[model samples]
Target: MCSHYEGPTADRIHHAFGIRPDGPVQTDLWPGHRGYYLTSGGDSGGLSVSTGTFGLLPHWAKDVKLARRTYNCRSETAAEKPSFRAAWRQARHCIIPAEAIYEPDWRSGKSTPTRITRRDGGLILIAGLWESWSDAEGLQVNSYTMLTINADQHDLMRHYHRPEDEKRMVVMLASGAIQDWLTVPAGESAAFLRQYPAERLQAEATG
Candidate 1:
């Protein structure tokens, strides 16, 4: 599974694509940070990462902090888990615009990182889901999670090796698949989602 990502050009491309660019975050030792946000039905908000927390605000949520830890959702059971089922069924779908994503190689013990990007150098429309939660202060928090699918045998898999890794990779939507993925009725089988070809991605090992 991917635990780190890069969104260097998120802001520049979001507007060009008619989407919103949330905000960026800076980690003490990380190379760089960027942000991405989304809006729907006249509601708008963006995502921000601070202290390693990624904050997302959805139209339905009253607070945005809830997204701090919900950045990833497992595809194997996302449709069955309480935290994700409802969003997966009803309020489903989000766009995570990223230039590239980072993956670690544990075998080297030196944290060898891999940068995965689209072969075409375009923004990757990562599949995600949004949800709203309420805090004690009555503030609503909006959060999101990136969905994962089983990774195909490839050079990238050499680095990710958790017994529970499940060999998963995030679901990178095809240009035309976004609208359909967002509007498809709930309870529908996700078979079509698994149909995307895996050859569209390219990954390289980096420092």
Candidate 2:
């Protein structure tokens, strides 16, 4: 599962969002850090961007630390997992705009951070789930997690992670299909969980 990434700049995001989020956009993101997520505004027929913690914060969560382990939700079990079930049932899907994602490559008997980006040099619009939580003062807080599918047989993504671990990659949404993914009924989510076509991505060792 991915834990680090480079996010799009505020200007780049503004072009897509029509406005920038309130503060500075984070360039490097990790679990528990702040980042931006896009959600479908109920009646606007458009996306609304919001800055929130990178990890998903379920209503029952006592603190934001849960984000560390909840950064990447496994697609196979997301609907049944406690940490992600509510968002799944609510169909709180979102797209995380990333410049690139960093993952560990363990090919040489050692771990080296590898950078993965789209071959076309466009933003990698990662599929995710977002949830809102209420703090002690009743203030609303938002958080999110990326959705991942098994990538063991993928030509590019399969090379990531340790050999002993199951390889997985985040689901990437195409621009044309973004609206469909955001508004589709929960039962149809499986249709959007497909692995991006092989070789549509490129990777290089960043460390």
Candidate 3:
């Protein structure tokens, strides 16, 4: 799962997606932390950038600990899973703009941190789902989770994680697909759920 990533700045987001931010800009973001995501700006017919908890918090959830496991939604089961069904059904989709995503490489019999970025050295927009839930204080708070798909066939992604574990990769959108990603209906959105080609990605071990 992608628990941490380098978030794009608000200005960068506007330049890339033409979405005016609705809140403060953030940089480094991790699960349970706050960050910005781009979604369809309801009524305005344009993209809207807004802050949300990196981990998802379903409206019916009573424990924030649920967030620990909800940061990443399996693309195959998102529509059927209790944790993500609501957002998936409502088509509450968003794009998580990131500079890089960190993963663990255990090929050396020990874990090594690896940073994955675009070969073009540009932002990577990951497909995600978002939901708004009321906190204990009765305030409506927003949260989101990235959507991931199997990557066992991927050349680069398969090299990460333990050899015994099934490989997974987040759904990264192409520069031209951001608009369709945010507006596509839920029933027709499955086409967007797939691993990015390793040829377009670069991964390196980080000290």
lDDT winner: 2
TM-score-better candidate, 1 vs 2: 2
- Score candidate 1 by TM-score against the native: 0.71
Residues 1-207 of candidate 1: C-alpha lDDT, one tens digit per residue? 555676544455545465443444432112112244332322333332212224333444434444544567777787787667777768556666567877765666556677777888776777777665566687654555677777655445534655445566777777766556665566653653552344677778887
TM-score of 2: 0.96
Give the backbone clash total of model 3: 0
Ten contiguous residues with the weakest lDDT in model 1: 25-34
**Model 2: per-residue Cα lDDT over 1-207, one tens digit each:** 889999988888998668678777678999998888888877879888888889899999888888898999999999999999999988999999899999999999899999998899888899999999997788898999999999999988888889999999999988788788888878989899989976788888988
TM-score of candidate 3 to 2 decimals: 0.94
Ranking, lDDT, top scorer first: 2, 3, 1
User: Candidate 2 — which residues are off by over 4 angstroms?
Assistant: none
Alpha-carbon runs more than 4 Å astray in model 1? 8-10, 20-69, 106-110, 152-159, 163-165, 195-198
